[model samples]
Target: MNDTDNEITTDESESTDSEAIAALTVRVVGPAGEPIEGAIVRGEGDGVEFGGETDADGTYVEEEADTSTYTIEVDHGEYEAATVEYTHDDDGEVTVELASPVAVAELSVRVVDSAGEPIAGASVDAEGRPHDAGIPLEFSGETDSEGVYRDTVYENAYAITVDHEEYHPETVEYGHDGDGGPTVSLEPIEGGVPGASRITVAVVDESGSPIEGAEVIGRGTPHEADIPLQFRGETNSNGRHPDVVYHNDYRIQADHPDYTGEIVRHTHDGPADVAVELESGPERIPVAITAIHPDTGGAIEGAAVRLVRTSGPDSVTADAETGSDGAALLEVEAGEYNVLVADDIDLTLVETEYTVAVGDDPVQTSFEAVTEPDDCVLTVEVVDGETGSPIEGARVQADVRAENIDDMGLAAGEADGNGIAEIQGWCGEWEPAIGSEGYWPADPGRLDVAGNDALTVELEPRE
Candidate 1:
């Protein structure tokens, strides 16, 4: 009996002294305290053999681990890895808390027009650094019928810009506040023409009734001998001209030449109209003269009195003048005159300029004038600098200096998308100038007429 008892005691002692290996029991669970299955658990420590997988109960027991600090890594798909550090307690359990992954936040944006109406089919995009730099983490969305756009983005700060054709682009910076996220509002763009101020002009006849077809001209400040003018459309039958004029005070002049010329101070504000009256003036007559002899340069009698009117297209030649000494003289009504001196012998002629004021009687004037036709045409293009592209809606101007001509001006033209522009009615030696916002003033002064049919000008971009 004593021997049997000693044998049992020795067996118990052998089992206790054989080995004192440290063991650890780890558990893997989700944030809800539910056991997560299929979780991979790895243990790292001195004498620790790493190998683990959570069972149905999300529990993994690591046996034979060293009695030192051991770290447990539990990973499940989509859920962030849970790490737990502990000193194995030879025979106990170490519990670990693993935080669940955060879900992505969604943003909803709405874009509206200036009238507070929802704008559909508008593009919305994140604007700053990471986004504008082509980082994929940035988000963008398009507005739907309800003007609402939705996008799921990681929690972060972002700058946003909204664009639509009719309205100006709007921009703002937004950040997540941890509560779902706030709605972003975008303002609409203004009208197509930038900085186009409105101007209303009243067109009135002698009786104050709006006269239709009367043109309104708004001239800009003069720069380098040329003042830019915007031509407003003719008055409607109602006599009111609601036009979009450039923002500038203008020297407004109204003319129906058969009528009295009216000048008034005008701004880009409300309707402005000046009254004009028509009066009949005496008919204008033309005068002509002739030179005689090829070498003597003397006037020949009976050279014929040929008078011509220089106002309209048709040249009205009436009386002719023969040379008395070396030149011929002809009589005509006073006002403005362009007298031509010609002869039967050599047809050597010249045009003389003279202005006849009131009380100036019809008189004789002589000249040794030469005839010359203009041989050059000028072409110009206008463009915007911000976008190295053409500006379709700019105006081009040309100033011509012709002998005996007062206010010889041409019509204003609108540029095409390619910034190409042309004018047909300009003649003589003239200076060409092009202007537009975002572009520099064209080189002013003079452009020589050298038999070239066309002149190409590239306007410098504005700073």
Candidate 2:
């Protein structure tokens, strides 16, 4: 008999005194105790080798063997190889259980939205196989409240699909070769103006009657690479305006001749519908004003008119613009107001105080121009800071610095071939700035038309 653990004596010459043992049985099974067929079982000891394939019941019996210990090795095409040490006292059988390689590893998946917020109750499905001939593997479950799904899979590559009611469905291929798991971000169904972009407006009177020909204007904050939220149009005969393809938070204004003006605040997540109501009464008075040139005695076109409430509990300001007939209309509350006409070509600033008592007729007045065409003009010359050469096609803008005006944007002018930009229709102190295509913007400073009519600005090129 061999003394080593793996060696079993097979010599018949020395085995006359000792009786031979019964057959040694080896059973191969999976980790879950299921039978594993076609597994190769081998044993070697004492210069004698014995091996055989497991039957349908995963059983392999050695009919002849001595009373010695043998090292058995079991191998399967779908599982990790396992080895066992067995001592044949000629009694019980040895069961070898093989484990899959994937059982030792773990996998995870997470689902979220475009805003990086987790989405719960999402369905996650995955399918894969351990090998070509191995058993198929699958995982189907819903994500937890934290939007995480965890499981163990037998394959290196898997196809995963995720679905949600409020979001678009997504599919991705995940591999277990890397460190971290996969994370999927799904787009929302009602995404924004770019996705479902439309805005609807409706105008009505106090008694819920439709008000036709009402002007509607909407403005919103600015953002890069997005559609600017600015639109203006008149309501149709049905008191409804055409859809505006924009989405954002906006301040909307609705105005009509026989009704009071209305302002509404709204937000558009996807598509939005808004309604505005105007009040009509004797408290709202209509005022008409015309502009005429003093020298030519003709009408002046395109002059901005402003009415500042000078005698009221709350300070209010209203504005309008003259049309081709040099006439504009304003609907306001009955009170004393400071009528201010802005400067334009051949016109100077006109400021006057007027009172509108209760139950008065529609007031009509005329504002005469006070300056020549070249009286209040500013000429700006743009040049390169380093080269001292004139720069053509530069843009110059001046904003009024008066305390009564809410919006300071007066007008803009472009430089001519001689690098000179002339801006007219500005009075008193103002702020001026210049910009060009290939150069950095010039520093903003003060420009008073009453003191200087010409100035020079320098621009530096970008590095």
Candidate 3:
């Protein structure tokens, strides 16, 4: 028996003094214990230049290997290349493990409208991605040909924002819950004008009886710009004025020749119906006020008419809203008053001082409410900074100041279930403030309408 160091006795060589040639068998397997067929198993440095690929069972055999150090190398395109070195002294078998190449994680985003229709040309932004900050915020994409965006990203928490001109934005923090990514839904900017959007006004008498044929009128309130609210047909037999109106509030005046007219403030933000009650009185002359656009000759529907007592006993104060005919009527004792007139949207109006004499004949008056049209709007949402979760009940306020249109002092609203708040949005530059309990109030900041039509207000908790 040749027991020298690094010597192997073969079956052909029975004498221990002879130099024996050793053989080696190599078996290659993958991570799952499956055979790696295409792996190249090479044995060198042993005076035996044997190189062969693994077979179906990942086994490679070298029949003749000398008693010397050998470097066994395995090369496969699909797996990491590997090599092992050892002395071959006898018929030896070794198992080589192959590993799969590392793969990069990826995520995708799809955007659609409230109607489930894919929205093209919508901008998408993502945060906490591997890319540089504001890279996606500035130019992620304007939605692809399929209205979807897919890319490799950092394996961590992410936030997505989608913006479109004619829709409210979609914003959320994201996680890879094995679904690849999220499909976000955006709400379309709904309803504006008489024939464009939807607004319902209900006219009723003191007893809650529907007043048919009662003229219905509405105009933008201070919360909105001086956009006109135009309605053509009168109330049907049901006394319900379901006309198309913008997403705004209006001072609605319902009038009937026999019954007294009533002025009511109604908000037509959503689908809720507004109710107006007309109080009937025994004796009253029609105090008619015609609010009109001097340039277009269109009767202004939502003019705010306030009669302040300029000179009288006690103080005669009465408020009325113009009807669809641009006229308002009220029963008042003959007195001197200063009629301060302004559009419901705070349009510039003339404050006329006049004297009222008790009479059956209608006292006619006319005032002009001039304004430049503005259709700007914005949407906002609040969220927690740490958890990246939506925060409900947050108060949001937008200060609107546009000359020739209207000045909305400070339109405020509370966040809803989705943490979204819709204020009378403004175009141009505006200031916004946000706050919630246990959270640091966001400092008031300027927002420009040129780029961001929607904004996310993230609140950091007070540690």
In terms of lDDT, which candidate is strongest? 2
* Model 3 stretches with alpha carbons more than 4 Å out: 1-288, 293-297, 300-306, 317-336, 340-365, 369-377, 380-431, 436-439, 445-463
The residue ranges of model 2 lying beyond 4 angstroms of the native Cα positions read: 1-181, 185-283, 294-297, 343-359, 369-463
User: Relative to the unseen true structure, what is the Cα RMSD of model 1?
Assistant: 30.6
Ten-residue segment with the worst summed lDDT in candidate 3?
130-139
| Candidate with best TM-score | 2
TM, every model? 0.23, 0.30, 0.23
Give the distance in Å from residue 207's predicted Cα in candidate 3 to where it truly belongs: 42
Tens digits of per-residue lDDT for model 3, 47-73: 457889989788988877777787888
Clashes of each: 21, 0, 4
Flag the better candidate by TM-score, 1 or 2.
2
TM-score of 1: 0.23
